[model samples]
Target: MKMLINVPETVVSDALRGLAAAHPDLTVDVEHQVIVRRDAPVAGKVGLVSGGGSGHEPLHGGFVGPGMLDAACPGAVFTSPVPDQMARAAAAVDSGKGVLFIVKNYTGDVLNFNMAAEMAEDEGIQVASVLVNDDVAVTDSLYTAGRRGTGATLFVEKIAGAAADEGAPLERVEALARRVNESSRSFGVALSACTTPSKGSPTFDLPPGELELGIGIHGEPGRERRAMMTSREIADFAVNAVLEDLEPTGPVLVLVNGMGATPQLELYGFNAEVQRVLGERGVTAARTLVGNYVTSLDMAGCSVTLCQADDELMRLWDAPVQTPGLRWGR
Candidate 1:
């Protein structure tokens, strides 16, 4: 498979350079592998930080700005960033108020961020953390001991970041982040396998006319593979999978996310079916966001994430955010 990267070894650095050039408001340290907001260490504000493997674009890195993450540390493609990187990010963003680390549930990420949290605390910077494990698709995977963190990572970051930006203390921000995680669930389906730059080929063998349900972002094995299904069929399966576990008492915030390679047109069509499913199940979509947010590298698929939203969650979700990937009401 052909990729735009100059070489596998420098793919992460090269992308970081480009991201730095594209977003001058962000301080991208390519060598140290940290991306931080230009106006970091906001006085009296709890800092927000999140990160993961490089393949998922516009996630941890693209989200560093005024109303998202204060800092992000990117690892290699589909690899976890080291504890030093996270520690550096925490140091960069931490105001006197404290910093909050938004961690996904993957084992490597969990371990590294936990170590980083301890390191930050030793440095006299009070810290709290929220572990996002909203992927209801699987309780255990190769990368995680519990449910894999996927699309809901975005929700946690946005909502918690909004709270932090409002000068909320570390404790409140951490609680909000954890509440968002607990109120959300996600399920993904893969139409084609992703290709990592290092491998330069499909990560898995997904035969044509077939699809894998419950796929992880790094192309981990999913629940099962079966013959390809239509957009409506896939939406039905994915939405039901999420709703079965979510069981929201009221309205929901829906994210119909493309898994990197899927086009906007297809994602919109799929979102319609997802809405149909929600309506049939007597659920109201308080707000709907579509397009690629949480993603796998060049994977032709999508995921549906549902967050059971109350008035407070909805207010935070609607708050102004000035990030490269997700910007609205700014």
Candidate 2:
């Protein structure tokens, strides 16, 4: 209900304007609603593109830069971007090395991005895609559209973009991305719900003292709801479930993402608890990241993602990456 905005319909478009102005290195395609790196088609480097709804800030758009994504398509708030936007990004960033599309496992995202791939192919562009379905909370693949690609999408984009930046072949990059997707698992808990700009109210209700488990980023109800508990207890439940599923043999990469509105100070404490639980379970976190990587609009919740890693994967994971959202190796 209490939000800083002039109107709902202009939320996404207006935000895009602000993003472009704030990050001069990223060029906003106002017409198509695509954000491309200021220096796209970096000679022979393969282009990387990821697109999704807008509310997930610093996602597809935040990640448009040198080492990560060449371009990102932003749809209306919580709505998938049309294929036309993606097609423009594909054309603008094609550098003869092909393009890799990192798509999340949402029905609308998959459909729109895949269609854009087709549109790009019509003009003889080589486009490959990897669908990230790493959320393990939703087990019934037959019933649901696989698992919701939550925080794992961040790892996928960074690692895959690094691979492409290294001049790895498109097929190899695609394969590596798939490996990350398969080896990763995620689960979330929500303490409060989010309100969309258009609606001007919470999407769903999570009573003052209740929390939902296995929650998705779209404000979708989780598999289970229960009484609130301490951070340690919540960390135990989330870490235990992910560790149980992966049983990672060696060092694993962990991401504790805040579902918007949870302050970073809290995220650090949350990560500490996550680390403690993993240590108790005899799991080593080779690389630990804690922040708001993927988030619901304004939901007070968090999700933890784990990717079982090998030497090669870890090396690739550590490789240089640059983007508006995630920039390193500067």
lDDT of 1: 0.93
**Cα lDDT listed for each candidate:** 0.93, 0.86
TM-score of each: 0.99, 0.97
Output the TM-score of candidate 1.
Answer: 0.99
Query: Could you give candidate 2's per-residue lDDT for residues 1-330 as a string of tens digits?
Result: 888888998888888888878888888977679899888878888888899988888787988776678889988887888999988998989998888999988888889898999999998999999998888788543223878888889888888888888888889889989999988999999989989998898888888888999888888778898999889999999998887788888889999999999999998999999999999999899999888878888998899999998998888778777666666673
Model 1 clash pairs are none
Q: In order, how many clashes per candidate?
A: 0, 1
Candidate 2 residue 42 C-alpha distance from true site, Å: 1.6
lDDT of 2: 0.86
* Displacement of the residue 325 alpha carbon in candidate 1, Å: 0.6
Clashing pairs in 2: 62-325
Tell me how far the alpha carbon of residue 325 in candidate 2 is from the true structure, in angstroms, after superposition: 2.2
Model 2, TM vs. native? 0.97
